[model samples]
Target: MKRLIHFAACLACFTVFLLGPTIASAGVSKKAQSDFEKNLLGKDVKALLDMPAYKDGLDLYVDHKVDKRLDERGIDLKDLSKYLKDKGVGVERDEWVTITDAKIDSDRIEIHLGGGGEGHGASKNAAKKGAGYKRAGGSRINFRYGRDLTDADVQADTFLPLLGRVLDTSKIIGVVIPKDVAPQFQEAIRSRDVVVGMSYQMVLISFGEPDQKKVDDSTDDSLHETWYYLKDGHRWVVKFVNGKVGKVQVF
Candidate 1:
């Protein structure tokens, strides 16, 4: 009887020892930690101050050692420390533009663009010459029309894709017109102000040539010339049949 009681006590003690951390961790409030981690995951903070949650979390984790919650999520303290030094998210800030004034909407995050201008001189000259300029002001011109970025733009990471949810085309552009706009923008061949051909040229005129183009030879000849657009966080495939638009899907 004594031996059985001793073995039972030892087993109970061992079980408690093993389950102590798990129970304690499970009971810890993950609300704040979750919100903080959600904002930090897949994000880098080089300048820290740009993102309030990152800045605060970094401070708490490094200085106050208040990172037990995050530690449970497989995040390394050293990685956070390096992120602080880098002053950017994911990679170096020099490689990617830091997004600021990020307004989190239901589907997309509207990031405020800052920094120098591009194509403004040409736009101004065209406007001065009465060539009809639609939007000409700052570097933010690229974001004005909601056009996807080109290969060059991708290298620069100028337009970051929004995750979590897909944005409605009408909501993104704030316009409700026929789907012909895609073709008209690409081919520069407008159709009676109704439907555009939505060819490669039209896409270039609107969103510019894709950074990367792929052709699927696996498909039959009737469904060839399928072009893919990759920019920021968005990917789109435009299918053409017999040199005409068949379907366009963006993700």
Candidate 2:
């Protein structure tokens, strides 16, 4: 009986010794970490700042600490450390970032950030600084349409496909629009409209972000998601089934 007890005790200790590191590192799965890196490495910081998804809750980190110096820019130096500790959202201020490493705990993804030094946000050598994406000729484009132009004049087939080509070729993260239905997407954007088959991303680009959102799982069928937009004197409600716009209700 004494030998049996000693054997059991030794086996328990051996189990813990063998499984300790595996358990410690099992907080986040390997696929989750890889997905984070694949999507975020070497992306523009300003565009990320404007993203609704990232702004909602994604946490970011920086290797260099925030500067607290008071300069001619009239920046405040007080309570900066406390503020960063309380709110972990300031890494987007960098013009661009190259994700150095991504570590995920059970709750959040800790992105180890590296970027251009101070006053180097627009540095042409972004790739040399970190493992960033190859710089596209132009990342952002703004168009000013004349009042006389109408949907008929725009040539949806030609213009829409061209835009999709540009976005696909640039390989920008998160701006996915299918090339096959480029004409349909073009009409949606030009008219600021939504249809049954349009994607959530397409709706956002078409009419901008929604003013409010809600989720409903009351039915025994499936999850239903809705986004409400108030414009001029009208309210637009868009419903989604499995992440694609299923219907639109106007009030």
On TM-score, the candidate that comes out on top is: 2
lDDT of 1 by residue, 2-90 (tens): 99999999999999999986764442134533442344233422221121112212221111223454342223446555433333222
Query: Which lDDT value does model 2 have at 83?
Result: 29
CA deviation > 4 Å runs, candidate 2: 1-182
**Candidate 2 weakest lDDT stretch, 10 residues:** 47-56
> Per-prediction TM-score, please?
0.25, 0.29
Flag regions of model 1 displaced more than 4 Å: 1-196, 215-223
lDDT of 2 by residue, 85-127 (tens): 3333224321343444434344333333342111223333432
The CA lDDT of each predicted structure is 0.35, 0.45
Measured by lDDT, the strongest candidate is 2
lDDT of 2 at 197: 78
